[model samples]
Target chain A: MFDTLAAMLDWFGIVVFTVTGALVASRKQMDAVGFVLLGTVTGIGGGSVRDMLLGRLPVFWVAEPAYLLTCVCVAFAAFFLAHIPASRYRALLWLDAVGMALFAVAGAERALLSGTAPSVAVAMGVITATFGGMIRDVLGGETPVILRREIYATAALVGAALFVLLSLAGASREAGLTAGFL
Target chain B: MFDTLAAMLDWFGIVVFTVTGALVASRKQMDAVGFVLLGTVTGIGGGSVRDMLLGRLPVFWVAEPAYLLTCVCVAFAAFFLAHIPASRYRALLWLDAVGMALFAVAGAERALLSGTAPSVAVAMGVITATFGGMIRDVLGGETPVILRREIYATAALVGAALFVLLSLAGASREAGLTAGFL
Candidate 1:
């Protein structure tokens, strides 16, 4: 029913990931190239891996170069805006959680549609939700947040599992999506 | 002219890369899971990305699951044998160079076969030869060899460039392959 809104949220997820990637590069005092590289990779790495794993050809960003362009711009701008307010930083954190959860459900859905086992679909969800950030941190020479923390991937796990279970129970996909977000 | 030999060399390249990855993970003191993860990804990451970008479906490893099994075995064994003699380590380093050169030429050849421009083919070559190690270091929280030194990717770049130039000059594909390793 809210396809446009869902699309907007998905776009926000990419932006949020890009911003975080750029911010992390700033923290590392990396050069402009570094900032852009980290940002673009963080924004798209997880989904790209997921698509590749599922044999989705050309991956998403290759099929849609605009996503790559948007990530570059967002990252370049972030280099200058690194001193943004702490309040906005807090807001970003909140949005990032929403983004990761959304990604988890989305990844599982894709895997299920591709006919993988439920267990593997759940793994796909966690990988989609957290891998981009993990890669960003790795490139920035830091330990990945996924390995350091409990909550990040656990939340994605819960969402992915619930989505699969709900789908199995013959619930509408829309309802499962709502449950994941909640 | 020596297709069988070339294929064998290619296989050796994968094994060498896997060993290097596992060794790096061992040096990082990562667990067994980490060793396997690093080794497998390092062995396959570059080519997988190349395929995805070129829209090659199902990826090579998924089509040949034996590659995955071999990587896992090699990585696990490396965990126990990490303390091997420095001479062996030196041997592996030399093998790695051969592997990288072989991969660079192989990658360019693949891209060229797919009808990409010579320039893009060369880029594909370097990406194929180096991105796996780059990902391995990033995952290990070490600065990537590609970023820290001038030589790592320069070697790949040279090999890739040579391969493309020779191919364009109407030399034998075999000539280009020879040049890459030389």
Candidate 2:
């Protein structure tokens, strides 16, 4: 049950991330290919880097084309959505935060499952949460948001650490996930 | 003999890449931390990405701290050298080209040794040759050098293909390396 929930949330997070990527491209006056490339990279770039660092084979997106397709679909949708009024910028921030929270816990859990130390798991969680945004900003010709004076990476670090501590305290993984998400 | 030569070239390339990264940081007026971060990423970023895609564990710099140290040293040196004059820009470009050529063949050879198909190996070589500069450009808030109309990625592509073809035609690996370098 927890696994299913996590998978669902992961897909949801991908959608949110992809939309933001596309939105950035549209704001930059980029074409379709730019939107798709940025969307795909922002949605999957972090987890792919994490998996590679852990030596997981076939990288996540390579093993599953569905994820790549989702990124493309959402990017296309965002291309249309970008025509709407500018107030949606506020919605983007909130959506990004929610997605970031979800990914942080999931990344930590995956690290723990893969037998990483608690510290490493926490770092993985943070990386998974923020690396995509970092890549997105960089590709968009800006400094990474997390590296700047944002409350972003800090939030990810705290949540990931909380999750890892809970797990190390012998709490159920589900309980840790809930706490981290909250 | 080939192994030794490859190793030496790899280190030389790292120094060149690191210097370029540091020079970019200087041009951007970044701090020490930025210089180090950019330098390290540019120096090892390509091989690290390739190894991860191939499921090679721990990434190269993570497994061997020496590469990271070399990047740091070169970055520090470049930080000071950046103030000298504008004439060094010419030298930087030549060094970058040499480094790119060396890394292309080395990346291809590594992929071939890891048992990937020749096509995949060639792609890996292109990636290894181009990825570091791509990352550095992104971090420095510029379009990637490869994405622009430069004789850059094309050079890496030709070298990688030449090396792979030479190997397939029953030439010694050293012969392939030398031919690819030229």
Candidate 3:
């Protein structure tokens, strides 16, 4: 039951990241292929890096094609939906926040499972939560949020630490995720 | 003596990758900061991914500031040298080849040292050699070579296999690098 919830959250995080990345690429006036590339990278880049760091095999996306398919679908949606006159910037921000929160908690858990120290796990969580967006921004020729004075990576780190503390305190994963996200 | 040679090759690879990335960014009319980001990512991105996969700590460029410093210097050079009209495409292709060869040999050696199987080590070598450029291209709004019907990844894989084969035959590191590059 717990595993199923965690897996769902992971997939949700990937979808959120993909949407954010697709939006960014649309704002940059990239073509469809470029949008898909950015979206996929934003969805899986950080976790791929984290898995590699943990010496895990095959990479997460390669083992499961669902993540890549989600990114592609998001990219397609962005292509048609970006024509709407709505405030996409706000949507992008919210989706990015959700992705950051979910990815941070999940990444920290994975790091801990891989035998990393608490501090390192927290750091890896932040990296896993943010590095994909950083790559997206860099590739899109924009300054990454980390390079800005925005409350980006710091937020992820705090959320990860909170989740770890809660887990150590015998709280449920759901409780920990809620606390971290909140 | 071999350590000194390895260090030199490592620095050379860093410089080449950085300069190439900066040149590409400049052609795209990006700012100085953009050039630096692209250059650094192109230079250290592959090795960072490789280290993460092998479960190495601190990452290579993060632990050794020399790589970062070399990239900075190379980026500076590229900023000034961009005015010259010496076939950017050709330069990019050849520089990529050199970078790929060096990375393939280095990655295979590192994977072997980390106790990976020969086949996995070769795959790691190919990933290390190609993934940086793949990331660079994707971010630059270009098709990644891996997705293209090019001989690029094939070259890297062949090089990696050659390096592993030579090493298994008790050849020196120098000999392996030479054979792999050739």
What is the TM-score of each predicted model, taking all chains together? Answer: 0.62, 0.63, 0.59
Q: Which ten residues in a row have the lowest lDDT in candidate 1 chain B?
A: B1-10
**Clash-forming residue pairs, model 2:** none
* Candidate 3 segments whose C-alpha is farther than 4 A from its true place: A1-85, A89-130, A134-182
lDDT of 3 by residue, B51-136 (tens): 87677865765445567667767777787777685788778888888888788777887888789999988998898888788767
Q: Which prediction has more favorable TM-score, 2 or 3?
A: 2
**Distance from true location, Cα of B128 in model 3, Å:** 1.3
Residue range B1-182, candidate 1, lDDT tens digits: 55664556556767888988887766766666566667877887788888877877666665555666777788889888877746554654565576688788878888888899999999999888888778777776777767675576889899999989998999987877888767
What DockQ was computed for model 2?
A: 0.19
What's the lDDT for all of these models?
0.76, 0.79, 0.77
Give lDDT tens digits, candidate 1, residues A35-125. Answer: 8999999999888888877697678789888889999999999888876757544654565577688788877777777777676576567
Candidate 1: residue pairs that collide: none
The 10-residue segment with the lowest total lDDT in model 1 chain A: A1-10
Candidate 2 residue lDDT tens string, B1-182? 87787777678878888887887777777766567667767888788888877877867665555776788778877777788866655765676688789889988988998999999999998888788888888777766787663687788889999999999998998899988887
What docking class should model 2 receive?
incorrect
In angstroms, give how far residue A32 of model 2 lies from its true place: 17
